[model samples]
Target: MPESLKKEIGQFNVFYIDYDNHDKGYCQSYRRRGFYKISLLEGETKLFYADKTMTFKRYALLFSNPNIPYSWELTGNNHTSFFCVFTEEFIRQFGMIKTYAVFKPGSYPLFELSEEQFRAFKDIFLAMQREIASDFLYKYDVLRTKVLDLIHAALRLQPVGKLPNKEANSALRITSLFTELLERQFPIESTLQQMELRRPAEFANHLSIHVNHLNHSLKEVTGRTTSQLIADRIIREARSLLQHTEWNIAEVAWCLGFEEASNFITFFKGREKLSPKSYRNSKIE
Candidate 1:
């Protein structure tokens, strides 16, 4: 990781990666416990996670909730880049409207940007960088506005595909809320020995509903069982840690809440058709 590029300011921070002074050796990936990133840039680059290549006309919004590991490569031409990093708390404090529908899990990772829209976003980042550097009063508050403006602009520009109608069923809404809550609890750290409610019975009990009812509601909407969804998330986290971090297999296994290293290996192999180490190695290739 680039030492200077890695920044932490209280709870929220933003950084700009200028192609001019930046070096390929300094190009590195980072994994944090809880954060989301939006990348605004120009020129061609390959985003590794979604296995997609993007140009200056394309913008990338990555909704990572501390569990998913992500990285990028600027292979083609040099271009300016800006990344805004913030936690849930930072976003909530800004008082921006929450359109969870746009950022929900499994959403598409890229959006094409119009020239005018790109210019507008570029201005926002420029202002944000200025705010970060200025010694003016209430700078944080001003920065907050810029952040909210960027989010609002993206929501307005991007098409959020058909979301589950909230008016349909109250039970489904509650179930959806419960599922979102469950997802938030994940990318669970390995040191947490006792499971913090992983099973369907546990979730149902927490939600004050029967296990069958929880299962039924989740299946109705997501087309997957609760356990399956949780397992999939775990696998995603495992892949991220294996690919992005220097942590070893046993450590990675423990971090994902697996009791034994062997069990983690078996589970990962079953899902990915490769061991963690093998998968990590493949990513670099």
Candidate 2:
């Protein structure tokens, strides 16, 4: 397959590409490090990411962090598009306050644009290009403003799905905080430590809440007990490491707080119906 849209690092490692060349099997196949892209074209294409394939239409916005792998397949060649790329630090220094929050790990990041909104975005890109070419002193600032303007416009036009109700939202907020904490201490290495951290009573004590109340809140909001959620998160992390890294079963188990490899094997088989190696090989094929 011809690699049409090769990667190029722009300002602060942001990737930029303008695909004009066409080959029979040309497609964009690569990953970005904290990248956001807005497509300004009327052409239809398929975007594959996060294990889902979706048809991308005119004026669509796609974003990915450093953690995800993504690729694109071009079905048609008649299109003109402009893209702006920048790193997380570049945006932090230049972007508005809430820009990072809007794209945080749990935040929904995809958006599709309306015709009018698309026109405005195209104008912003054009302006950015002109500014880049000139000897402007505050060109970076101009770019930052345009980027924020684009984000604000999208927020107004796009719906980030439904947030929970007020009470549910409050409960979910606590649950999210707890989940983040648990994930930070992941890959349980020893059963003793897992007991120390994964026990619902201990977690409730650390959060300064009664155990029963904590259980009730977490169950109501996430439909799972606190321990179940923790176990699931650990398993998910194990799967990621097994699939993406060349770690052996013993090492994987040790990293996840398992003292013995046998327990890890049993856990993997119980949840996945296959050993870690089998699952990994199946995915690659």
Candidates in order, TM-scores: namely 0.52, 0.48
lDDT of each: 0.62, 0.60
26-96, model 1: which lDDT tens digit per residue? Answer: 23344564566667766555553322233333444433333323466665555667777776656665442
lDDT of 2 by residue, 84-112 (tens): 66654446655423235444333444566
Q: Best-fitting candidate, measured by TM-score?
A: 1
CA deviation > 4 Å runs, candidate 2: 1-20, 24-41, 94-102, 159-285
Off by over 4 Å in 1: 1-9, 25-29, 50-64, 95-99, 159-179, 183-201, 204-285
Leading candidate by lDDT: 1
Candidate 2 matches the true fold with a TM-score of 0.48
> How many Å off is the CA of 93 in candidate 2?
3.0
